[model samples]
Target: MKIFNTQTKRKEEFVPLEGKRVKMYVCGPTVYGDAHLGHARAAVAFDLIRRFLEHEGFHVSFVQNFTDVDDKIINKATEEKTSIGEVARRYALSYLQDMVALHVRRADFYPLATETLPVMQDVIQKLIAKGHAYVGDRGDVYFDTESFPAYGKLSKRPKQEMESLGAQDKGLSEKKNLKDFALWKTRETKNEVGWDSPWGYGRPGWHIECSAMNLHYLGESIDIHGGGQDLIFPHHENEVAQCEALTGKPFAKYWLHNGFVNINHAKMSKSLGNFFTIRELLKQFTGDQLRLFLLTSQYRKPIEFSLDILREKLPLNQRIEAALEYLERNLQVAGLTPTLLYNEAYRGDYGFAATSTTDETEATAEENTRKSLVASREKFLQALRDDLNTPMALAELMNLVKIIQAWNKPPEVKSPSPSIVTIKFTFIILREILDIFGLYPRDSGNLHPAVTHLEKFIDAKLQERTQARKKKDFKKSDAIREELNKIGVEIQDFPNKSTWNWRK
Candidate 1:
């Protein structure tokens, strides 16, 4: 597998430091507010990478940290008149809830900044002892950027350029150099959140928390370190300097950064007043639809956020779902159970098609379809392996759906055959591929309470229509169907039974 490494500015082969075991870390959210679409984008992008790695038979130990005690968290706590811990916990839970709704797999470890304070202090003391950091008169400690000769290597910016940009910022007058960043900030007020450290009562700097946690959790060196592209300059660069300065080893083998999300041709931000939260988007689109929209483009390409784009991609999800449902219905009609097909497909024992001693044309078509299935499966896997090209992978998935839908349209078939078995195999392949992208919906067999109630209500109405028709009450039955139609329920009648679905 190959992935684009931000540090090298090229796609490189991915070989984990430890064979067959991958250590991946992605910068998670600072729990100060609801997670916006930008957060979701980062979360989903890494989630895809993690899932793909696991699917390729790698043991992936993923860690995504929560910045639970940051300036934003402290400010939010003060504004809400609550403790920082309370504010952090509230939003942390909210963020996890959103991740669950989006079907993002939880990381192996979610270390919080507050929980990793001691680790941060240990790293800071080492930096200071090695003369890479110094304590200010006011009990603050700043990293000595000049001490690390390779400071600007990760970001590829000259020291002078970074110094010029850092000089314009306020509140760093005590630093020896403009490019120096804080390792610990001494508490200036009683109300500020802090912890007791060798530098006095202070807190870890924003950049130090990640460096400390990454070391404590995944060791001094890891396979991959990733975050949004915006963090490449100061955040990730500082992390690299601190880790490499302390361990004298490469911080990570590969650096991956996802692209930004834009709204109205501008980057989406809370301050911009155009940000949309994950919860808000979920109200309008299913989790699968949202995942599909996010994966429509390459992971490192910026995506434009708009309802129009979402609407266009939603039918893709619906089409996949409808195809799966059609497969199930056909299986039932042919007296073939999903379990039987599942077992056969799992064993790679799809029975051969009927002999063509009486008809050669039908045999030829079956052979062609079998070949098509094998080709589609190979293409789908190849697309994912090629830097996780989800757009191309998704196209292969749609092709499989078309093949299944075409096979399902028939006059009548009394019994199941190898042809039906082929359809089931195709269905299983598509389902597995969709799952790797985290696009599969939870089984509807476990319905929400509201949906369960609605289903019962609709069943009652259908029962009433059935009773009226049995009694030859044509007028009442027609009235009942008309009422259901008015409420956006479309019913289809069969010789033996009836089914209904929501129209809109």
Candidate 2:
């Protein structure tokens, strides 16, 4: 598998650092607010990466951190007359709920900034002892950016150039240089929650939490580290300096950053009044449709979200939804005996793999058509290997849908014979492929407990009407049916029993 390594600034074949046990870390949502569509893109993009790696038989340990302690979370807490922990807890849960709604699997471990205070402090003290960090005049710890050579290697921006040119936080005091950011910040107000550190009672800086958390969890050299590209500056750059200067180990093997998410080509921000939360957008599209729209663009490029484009994404989602409903319904109603393990006759070795951990081998003539389908899969996966090219991957899915639509409806479609296995693999294999894409069928007939209750109520009323009719109580039977019809549930009294269906 090829993965784009940000450290090398190119797409390279992915060889796991520790022999196929991929240790991946992604920067997760800040707990101050609800997750947005931009968050959805990053979350799902990495989710796809994890899903595909596991599909290829790799044991991947994906870790994502929750920045629960930050200026934003503290500020939000103050605004709501609540504790910072409350602010963090409330939205962290909300973010997880939104992720579940969007079909993003939970990370293997979710480390929080507040919970890792000791870890952060340990890292800060090490940096201080190493002469790479120092206590500022007013009880704050700052990283000495000038002390670390190759400081700008990741960002390619010289620290000297950014000295005065760099910016500092509001009310945040200047360190020795503007480029030197806070490793530990003092709590100015009494209400703010902070820890008693060697410098003072304060909290860790924004960048330091990730550096400390990652160092504690994934160790110095991690297989992958990812976040939005906008964070490449003071945030990620400082993290590199803080860790490398302390541990003297490569901070991360690969640095993967996602591009911006614009709203109709306009930048989305709270200041601009254009930011929409993921929960808010959920009202607009189903989880699957939103995933499709988010993946339509490559992660390295900006995604411009607009209603007009979103409307276009619906048709693609509809196809998946239609198929999902069909598959689930068939599973429910079709009582076919389960088949035993057998070698598939499909030839191309493309599409969805048939059930069985059989060895991948040459496909037959029928498998050949499936192999043609493999072209699309190969192209799709190549796009991913090349820096997670989601747009290219989506294009492949579009091509697959086209093939499914154009497929010849044989009288009775069956698995291909051994000689023809490759030819017949497309349909089945594509389902599995799409499933990894999080676009496979979902049970459409599922309803709330209330809907089931309503159905049962209608059924009871229908039964009563059927019994009345059987007794020749014409008036009672008519009244009973009329009562059910008023509630928009239609009943058909068949010879065997009373049948009911929801009103269209």
Candidate 3:
């Protein structure tokens, strides 16, 4: 598989450091407020990479940390007149809830900054002892930028440029070097949120939390380290310096960063005042709908957001959902068992579980369908393998849906052949691919409450309309049709019967 490494600025082959075991660490939310689209985008992007890794037969130990101790969290606590722990726990739980709603798998470890204090302090001690960091005059410990000759390598910015920028900012005036960043920020009193360290009472700096967590959880070196592109500069670069400085090894084999989410031609951020909370969008759209819309663009490119575009993508998601329901319902009616595996259970190449005769020997229709199914699955995997090109992968999924819809088009045939069973199982394999994408339909059967209710109402109305037509009450029949139309229902008439579906 290939992944675009932000540090190298190129697509590179992914080979885990420890055989087939992959250790992936992603920067998670700060947990000061509710998660927005920006958070969801990064979460979904890395989740896709994690899922793909698992699908490729890798044991992925993914850790996404929560920055439970931050200036924002502290400020929020002061504003709410509550403890920092309360504030952190509130938003952290909110973030986990949003992840669940979005179908993002929970990370193997969700270490909090407050809980990882010991490790953070230990890392800082090593840096200070090795002369890579020093205590500032004000009691804060700042990293010694001059000590690490490769300080700017990951960010590709010259020390001169960083020095120039730091000169303008009043915050760096106290540090020995302009590029020096805090390893620990001292608190004035014991009442504040801090721990007793060798350098006095202070909290871990923003970047140090990740470095400490990565070291404690995944060891000194890991396969992949990922976050949003915004963190590429000081955040990730500093992590590289601290981690490699302490362990004298590569921090991570590959660095991955996802692109931003734009709103009104500007990046959507919590500080920007143009962000939409994931909770707000969930009111009108399902988690899968939101997820599908986010994946419409490639992970490394920004996606423009608007309700119109989101609604337009609704049918694409619905098409996939409708196909699954149609195939499952039809197969069950034909007394055929639809065997499928969950996303985690899928080990790749399990899609062809149902044996079939030679394609040339099968009927022409079945032969063509089987070829399309096999081709679509291959295309889907190929797209994902190519740097996780989700748009291309989604197109392949749509093609699978089209093939299923075409084969099952009706005048409902009930004489289930072995070919049909093979096609159904193949479709289930395609569904496994969707699961890897984290797009699972809520109802794969005919038991969706809203859908079942609508069916009963529509069926009753259709019956009433039929009686009206038989009684020569043409006006009443027309009125009934108009009523259904107002409710976004359309009916297609046939010689023996009629069928109904939501109007496009």
TM-scores vs. true structure, each candidate: 0.83, 0.78, 0.83
lDDT of 3 by residue, 313-358 (tens): 9999888887887777666777766553333334344444433555
Residue-level lDDT tens digits of model 1 in 373-439: 7788778778888877888988988898777766556647322234555566666676667778897
Candidate topping lDDT: 3
> Runs in model 2 with CA error above 4 Å?
170-174, 323-368, 408-424, 443-504
Error of 1 at 326 (Å): 1.8
Evaluate model 2: give its TM-score. Answer: 0.78
Q: Order the numbered candidates by TM-score, best leading.
A: 3, 1, 2
Please give the lDDT score at residue 440 for candidate 1: 63
Judged by lDDT against the true structure, how good is candidate 3? 0.83
Q: How many clashes would you count in candidate 1?
A: 0
lDDT of 2 by residue, 415-497 (tens): 22332233234444556567568763452222223445777887778778878888999999889878876654577767778
RMSD of each: 11.7, 11.2, 13.0
